[model samples]
Target: MRLYWVILCLVYSGSAVSDQKVYRWKDKNGNWVYSDVPKKGSEKVKLSTNMLTMPATDTSILTPNPATPTVTYQAKITAPSDQQTLRENSGSVYVNGLVTPRFANGFQVQLFLNGKATGPKQTTASFALRDVPRGEHKLQMKVFNDKGMLVAQSAVTTFFLHRASLLNR
Candidate 1:
């Protein structure tokens, strides 16, 4: 394997160095061989001088512009208004929220129930909570930037969940 790489290097370098001579011959094992040194029964090989190259890239496009100001976001819970009561036998709740000045790209939303984060962060402003125990709960929505920094948060909205009891069935 080492010999194969050595021969390949010689062949490729020979093409780049036009002044160097390359020789090709078949060894006793019936395998074609390439080398910079000429051997008995070897023939001189001509390599093409043409090579492909790409222009240097402009790095200015990769850097962010410092003049653009960062946007400030405000989040609000639009559904399940504060102090509202929800009735669901399955304890499921649907939450909806909105962001002022439009939600930007690379931003995410997270829902907090009773001061604890629920479910994964999402790009949309809506969330579906399941299997919540019947009782009072606090809900809040927070917005995060691409860097995972907290950008905005909604005022805590208090609500009550009521579920049908089996004894009342």
Candidate 2:
């Protein structure tokens, strides 16, 4: 479903024209690099527009009945401990908690890191974040309705990510 937007956006922007040729090459670190303009000795790669073949969506999912009830809530973050230091080597953290009055119809919880929305819209009040960088970060949760309207929000929770230094190793 997410690929629909990406392909649609690319099609509208004309960034993925079928005739456009892309160059592929390996850098010093052995990572594959792709770009429109070819550097000296770079190989021209042919990419087909197979992404245009996307499945169609049913109309029933898009149209929602107007008789649904609206509910509001206030959620809070209960994990990672406010101002706590996490020492996970991989920099992963799990956040979970309860929402007051329970969740209403179509309500979803979203996690925000440093004021940026992260992860998928979920019906549960739990978030598993990966690769949190080293240093302090702020996390918050928000609940929204099926119409994408803001319903409930959690207080701002701050924490520090402690990573083992590799420079001195």
Candidate 3:
């Protein structure tokens, strides 16, 4: 039978396992027959594969991420209108902002002034920026835990400072 030869070839041909080919043909009785032996009317047939395999996948990629509320991590500036001109009082500027859900215990607000970090970390969002040179400036806020891991942030705001010369006094 063709099935018999196919199995024999698989067991005997250890190296050419995938390359093995079998033959199939019908006898004078019209009965279906299978064999590896070549016959006058036999047709070539591929080896029967009884096994299947699937690639391993990462389950994390298929799972949905947990949702986090926006209010719990919001950082917003409430003072110093963007692009507004200011006449600094005694070279001091008050940077005021609001943080939602209140800061966690060990978390602090950091102010970025003119693209540079300024002042010491504070538990409050309000800060007193002193002696800022007259020029255009940008400000933004970042929240960090006691371990210095960034948690939340606010958009950058640009403001201009104009200080009159003391010669006019």
- TM-score, candidate number 2: 0.56
Whole-model alpha-carbon lDDT for candidate 1: 0.93
Candidate 2 error regions (>4 Å): 1-72
TM-score of each prediction: 0.59, 0.56, 0.55
Q: What TM-score would you give candidate 3 relative to the actual structure?
A: 0.55
**Clashing pairs in model 3, backbone N/Cα/C closer than 3 A:** 1-34, 2-34, 2-35
Provide the overall lDDT of each model, using Cα atoms, as 2-decimal numbers.
Answer: 0.93, 0.85, 0.84
Clash pairs for candidate 2: none
Pairs that clash in candidate 1:
none
lDDT of 3 by residue, 1-169 (tens): 9999999887877656666677889888998788767788899997766556788887986776667444457888878878888997477889899887787799999999977889778899998889988889999999987798888999998889888878758
Assess candidate 2 and give its lDDT: 0.85
Model 2 C-alpha lDDT per residue in residues 1-169, reported as the tens digit of each score: 9999998997876754767889999999999999999898799897876655668877886788788885557788899779988888798888886788887678789999999988788888888888989899999998887899888888899999888888748
